[model samples]
Target chain A: MQISASKWLDIWQANRRLTRRVIEAFPEDQLFSFSIGGMRTFGDMIKELLAVEGPGIEEIVTGVRQKFDEHASYQTKHELLDKWDAETARIDKFWADLPSEKYLERVNLFGQYESSVIDAILYFVENEIHHRGQGFVYLRSLGIQPPFFWER
Target chain B: MQISASKWLDIWQANRRLTRRVIEAFPEDQLFSFSIGGMRTFGDMIKELLAVEGPGIEEIVTGVRQKFDEHASYQTKHELLDKWDAETARIDKFWADLPSEKYLERVNLFGQYESSVIDAILYFVENEIHHRGQGFVYLRSLGIQPPFFWER
Candidate 1:
């Protein structure tokens, strides 16, 4: 059975809760430490998450692709949290207003001609988990236990 | 700068490597245990990853999502590896062919108005990391140390 838009919204809500909880687990001081080289620090990844989605959404609505600079200012945990709340709310509204039939419509995704609306939504949740996983590792490396595992 | 599609592909390749290596490090019998209730068993999570992405991609393409049965055919680590490899190959090919401009296009994602293709691609990579992080906790709960953190 194809997942309907409403189910996708529920998933998004669950994911938002998980992601926010994960981000909040770390002490603000360690957010930027290089627990490992090459991979982004936990804080950097959080910043990246905040920076990317809104601009990406803007690009889609306007049909214009814009360059995202890595060094753009996203300095504080509070800012990231605020942005996360705003972006998720915006996304939720977007999903709520979406028509169900478009879920099957193919769209170009980063040069690939494959995407159902639901797949994109699933990816949104999945991507956060991937990076936050790194954050979890960072916490462990510092000998700071992350929030209880199921707290997500 | 806007990330090239190849950047995402490269990241995904690296992510798969990291995730698999994590799995490989686990003792076979302990794969299903976790300290957190409702925390997906490591094996169960891996199966979910495999089961979801391919069929999810198929759903994205054809607009028909399938309900996944609780048990996947692969009970052994080797079987899971095989499925993971095969599915990775499939996704790589589909992604490699993606047209770069579509990254900015709006398209329906699970009945949502449409997210930028770039966000979708980012979501794919990020989602993997998110779950893989959970897998890491499961590893630690077993008192089993994981591989070198930066191998990816």
Candidate 2:
């Protein structure tokens, strides 16, 4: 069950690619405003997801902590997709220099979630799958078929 | 991040516990037939998830390949929960015996997906999270509040 930090970077990148496709599937109109029952819209979910990456990983790579923020960036679907792509490249740049053994060491994620870097890393992928699931629901409700999960 | 094979077992088990709570949130009558739109009912999604573990991990451990089967088990929520609990324990029993190094080696999952055993193991959790996201939508549409994502 051990994953090298490089392999984890690959895994994270793959999932992020799939998530980008999920964002693409959204009708721009419903991306942020539609909600099932009282649940938050896909936009809000996406924002929360975007917020988790850059700062969280930065904190791990550097010992500096940061507060989680989802509301400050990207108010539109186009902007979110751009931000997602940029974040993808950001990880590509930072992930390579990250030592695999560092994943085994503890990192205080966002100064709130305190756990091993591996656990925090897993949380990134886990959170995406969860949010994408919500997006799938949103798409189906709007009569759109999301990109197939296996395509990733 | 390096997760010993045993620690992966713990991580998987913790996530399973949360998923079980999600199953518990479903109204007995709606667990099987509920859908957000044209999406498969949460029950069918659950069955696909149930099919992945047990036999999948067993194949990794015993080197005896088992075909994927999602339709052959469970006709009711009662049976499903029982199966889920049993599978949880089954993982506990077998997961420890799995060599941590095996996770670094590749295994063709259910004769289709091929990757390192660690990737396949992560898929088990990722797939469940995806389906559970659908379950969340189903619950919300039915006027039920689903379990919180972070509870895991």
Candidate 3:
């Protein structure tokens, strides 16, 4: 949907900002509340999103799965937010350095069917949007107000 | 990009099946295991994916932020798999029901931005591929073997 390379970056940045705002809106105690029946807590969703930009993208670009710190802990909402901000910054640079033609080239995604780089990038944005919508529902179910959806 | 609507459906169906296989490959204990440090266990990621579909589609159909999850309980892995199967079926039916001109019309995705219906469909497939890639990484980290990348 985003035609230009710069447009992708813009969309990514907006998505990251929106996600961060939603994470910030939740109280610390509610972050890990997995008691919403079978739903993951808001904290859980944010962690998944944060990791996707760093470990997820790292694997995509390097063609190798990086061994992550299996015990890395985030004690506070700030820790998650910090990681979210840092990874977005890293992704912005990654996008800046990426050539537009690279988007059309197919890459081995986890040894699965080869997918074009453009489709992969779109996947990244769409995945975040999907999760962010979940975070909104979690927030409302917890009686917390989510950030304005259009801030992005 | 897949120019034909049927071509996009074919790809989307393939991507959904791959996700289903990856979800089936993991054990029950790790579904919610965020214990792997920076990684989101397969369970959490799958829930996020399932939770987003209704709202995401609602966004595409409506121009405003629809109420978030007025009626969704957190679904189990089996429940999620059932959803994945149902969505794939629903998508095929929805695609068949559409007129040719709807593919070219720009639709509002929850007021986030405007995207053509075709681009929106492409976005769905790409999102599944990205998360399935993460599932593979999680599987490998846990010393489990993922489904063959090209078995489909």
Candidate 4:
């Protein structure tokens, strides 16, 4: 394998850690309201990420498909962070349930995206990084310094 | 291998194609002058990408260290696109010279970042996606629709 399953997971977790820092850097008031160029707010983007990872892993572990949902409401930044923390643990559990061979299996992710398990996992991380990049701009525009991109 | 080296190269090329589309979506003048919230212009980001991939691959192929440079000035968007096209071809040639076994070897990329060749290559793609996400915001702010992220 070009990369072992564990190494790839480690990379994904590192990215997740960086993303969490981006989320924490946002001012609470701006978390949901701030946006540039009609883009979705960082808060909305985080919800989309929260919607995907844990449920996506669950779907991968079992044969059941998940409906993509990004409309969960977290009335406060604290609430959002709580959910984010919970989802991280849930993802670890679901990920541990995934067999090594399943990494190569083709499955329909969220009943929307179709690809090998590996590709789907890669997309999950890529999507977060893309959104996080936008978050970085949002932070910079607000005169705040974002966490270093390579620190992950 | 979880993914063959050729398949990984194909993925990188696909990302390059999508990034090229992002570059094409920008107005010539705005390509260098337009940015939101004090971020670097998408053109500058493109130059950084141009500085990395081809040279990074060459470094991996020959054990040569490259000095990271993003200071090349292109007077027009056409010139930048021309360089982008040339780099794509150069990256392919350099990539072909890289033996599959070398994917697992560690080296200092740009005489700065040290990691296995595969991780370094992944960083190249992730960095592009990161900047492209910002470009998407720049385009939307300009009332121009950027290319779809998943089309890559």
Q: Score the docking of each candidate (DockQ).
A: 0.15, 0.76, 0.06, 0.71
Highest DockQ against the true fold, candidate:
2
Q: Candidate 1: TM-score?
A: 0.52
Interface RMSD of each: 11.5, 1.4, 10.6, 1.6
Question: Per-residue lDDT for A16-126 in model 2, tens only?
Answer: 888899899988888878898898888888888878987778778877877799885567889999988888887787776677758778887876788888788778888
> lDDT tens string, model 4, A116-139?
987888889989999999999999
Off by over 4 Å in 4: none
In model 2, state the lDDT of residue A11.
Answer: 77
DockQ, model 4, C-alpha based: 0.71
Estimate, for each residue in A1-152, the C-alpha lDDT of model 1 and write its tens digit: 23345655665566667778767776777666654534566777777666555544444344455455445566667876887898788776655556665554554543432455444444556566666675666666666666653343
Enumerate residue pairs that collide in model 2: none
Ten-residue stretch with the least lDDT total in model 1 chain A: A109-118
| Candidate whose TM-score is highest | 4
Q: How high is the lDDT of residue B136 in model 4?
A: 88
TM-score of chain A of 3: 0.84
In model 4, what is the error at residue B45, expressed in angstroms?
Answer: 0.7
